[model samples]
Target: MDFPQRKIIHVDMDAFYASVEQHDHPELRGKPVCVGGGKYGVVAAASYEARKFGIRSAMPGKLALEKCPELIVIKPRFQRYKEISQQIRQIFHEYTDLVEPLSLDEAYLDVTENKKGIESANQIAREIRETIFEETGLTASAGISVNKFLAKVASDYNKPNGQKTIHPIQILEFMEELPIEKFYGIGKVTANKMHQMHIFKGSDLKKKSLEELVRIFGKSGNYYYHVVRGIHRSEVKPHRIQKSVGVEETYWENLLDEESVFKQLKLISEDLEERLRRKEIRGKSLTLKIKYRDFSVYTRSKTQEMYYENLEDFYKTAKKLWELRPFDKPVRLLGLSLSNLNTQEKKQVSVQLKIPFPELD
Candidate 1:
């Protein structure tokens, strides 16, 4: 069977949070700037200039300053970022409704049959990038391809206000030359394992048979096999409803005691509360995830009849769940998530099973 080709575009704002900071404060442009938590806090985003000093998101702010003495740190203003994100999203809707937002700064758009009747996806991407700069005073990079995976990879090829198109005819050639580390979902740990197995590039990954890959990587092997062949069947879904909202932190040092763990939980709960308020969402179930130093994982959850909306409520429930778990080992990661979401959307049910032979029986 033959599959219809799709026109997928991935738009990623270059250094989104940091860029917004620069756009708002002209003095910060062309200088190293980190936008996120303050000194002794976690770095949320780093500008391209700061990146020159090896600063990155999630890095501790104190260390970031050590790397660049003149680095300017600014707290995140998520409300302002959300406002700009909405504006960019409106522009995407003008062309196609098939937009899947990955974050406040990036989204995937399927324009195979766009409202504008434009034939070239590349032209559409260019126009979108230009319009974003003109309207929002911020620049975005775009990747155009036949699938989301390829489009996302292409978008990163040219950083900071550039675009690239991977034509259907060039897909195989492009994939062959791409590095294994560059594939979406392939992280440091997985890349290290791949290297140990002598799979260092897309061509090397493609050399492995589907059976070999499955035997090596389990169910994810099938995903790797298809993606290496330039086949990704995922759709660009619009209005994707989130089922959970959560926050996690990986401490630089192990959290050895209950007191330290509780402190981290309080911080996480506060962050989750702010995020929930931004989305106007609440959940009836709370879950706690703990990762040990050995990388082992465990989770605990509790469900309540009442919706939780505040930090105190989330912390109380999460604390109870945490206290119930055994913590003989030091913890490397801690996370709290709320599920059973209340989105206010009308819920519907569909049939799950059917027996066509019931009459004959």
Candidate 2:
């Protein structure tokens, strides 16, 4: 059976948060800048100038300054970021309704049947990039291909302010030459595991049988097989509601005791509650995720009949799960997530707030 060819484009904003800062503050442009909480907190975004000094997002602000003493640190303005993101999304909607946003800074667009009646996907990508820069004074990179996976990978091939198109004929050569680390969804640990298995590149991955890949990598083996063949069937979804909202932190020092664990959970619970309040949503299910020092992960979850929307309730559930789980080793990471969300809506008035229309016969 033959599937219809698709024209998918992946657009990624270049250093979104940092770029926004530079765009807003002329003095910060062309200088090393880091947007984050503070010296004690983690770096949320780093400008390209800072990246040259090895400063990166998620690095501690103190460490970033050490790497580049001239680095100018600024607090994140999430509301401003969201506003810019909405503007970028509006630009995406001009061409295609089929847009799947990966985050505020990037998205996948299915443009096989676009509103502009454009025949060339490459030309469409160029136009989109040009328009974004013109309207927002920001640069974006685009990758065009027949599927989501390839398009995403292609988008990163050219760094800030560039675009790449992988034609159908070029897919095979592209896949074969691609490094294992370059593939999406393959993290550092997974890449290392693949290296130990003598799978250093896409060419090596394609040589493995499906059964062998599954036995080695579990369910994800099937995904790896298909993506290497340039066959990703995931569709672009425009109105994608989040299934869960969660936050996690990797400690500078491993958490060794139950007291420390609970203290951290309490803080995380507060953060989650604030997030829920901001989103105006509640959840029936709560989950606790713990990662040991060696990178092994474990999760415990509970689902309630009624929705919960407070910090106390979340803390209670998470604490119970933590106490029940074995903790022979120190913990490197901790997270709390709420799923099965319920968004609060205004109730309809029983009595007419205004004059009602006359009943029809």
Candidate 3:
């Protein structure tokens, strides 16, 4: 039997941790404050106020302090954040059980068959946003799209109490002007590479043939092509324990050959594979990690549409990755892992297996 058209919603709390701080501490409201940085560390969360002053998460405490000398820095209160996350999760459960959390501050919900029987998924998202604001006093942005890729992208189209819905027909147009740098998997390095190739926006990326993109970008290019075409086939699955599981090993000697690297990585992969079997888990993403003679490190990963369960599968994925080393240095350490999980979720794997993308591939 054919199923009803699905509705997926991506919700992100506005500056979640920092916003929470502002909500509880009246003194912090409307002022620049960072929710991390106690003695010597990094910023975990930056208020919009802090962002305005060039302060951001992961900026060194020293640099963040320099950016905004008046920045009010506070240690993270995980208990409070967890409590709030549970509260928001409760809100999500009120509508659908097919909820996947990206982190403490973000989640994706599949409500095609919601308890509320709402015909319009956008309306459900809107109602959830209103409930969150009234009950939790926090603002969230919602993105609604035909698939997870577009839904995630739509969510970011607006922020801080905003919502964006992209119908399937509108998906292609919506991505045309999107900056390459802003694409979820494209990071600073890849964006620079794409810029050098005269691909600055999604339109530019779309202009390239999939084969050409594969020549330049390898496996990720296929996803890039599909994303621009708005043909992403990933789903919105129920929340689970882990999407990724991994193990790493460090060696005293810096090995210089591909054979040695693969051999060592094989050992790591074996343990990981056994664990995966024991847990009855499967994954689409595989990562091969390496540390070079100069102590520089790089990781390459590949995610297939299907999850893998065999050791040979992981080894092949790893070997392919090892062959793709563009800059080879003596290997100092190596590791392996399987991720993109859907633990006990009893739902189809979504495009989320598409993430953890920065690895060496």
Point to the candidate with the largest TM-score: 1
lDDT of 1 by residue, 291-326 (tens): 886668899999989998799998998889987977
Please report, as a residue range, the 10-residue window in candidate 2 with the lowest summed lDDT. 349-358
Writing each residue's lDDT as its tens digit, candidate 3 over 137-168 gives 88999999777767787898888789999886
Model 2 misplaced stretches (Cα beyond 4 Å): 1-4, 245-282, 285-304, 308-338, 342-361
User: Candidate 1 has which clashing residue pairs, if any?
Assistant: none
- The regions of model 3 sitting more than 4 angstroms off are 1-5, 239-361
How big is the positional error of residue 27 in model 2, measured in Å on the Cα after superposition? Answer: 0.7
lDDT of 2 at 327: 72
TM-score of 3: 0.69
Quote each prediction's TM-score: 0.78, 0.75, 0.69
Error of 1 at 242 (Å): 3.3
- Candidate 1 similarity to native, TM-score: 0.78
For residues 212-270, could you state the per-residue lDDT of candidate 2 as single tens digits?
98898887888888888888887776653456778787675679998999999999999
Candidates in order have lDDT scores of 0.85, 0.85, 0.79
Error of 3 at 241 (Å): 6.7
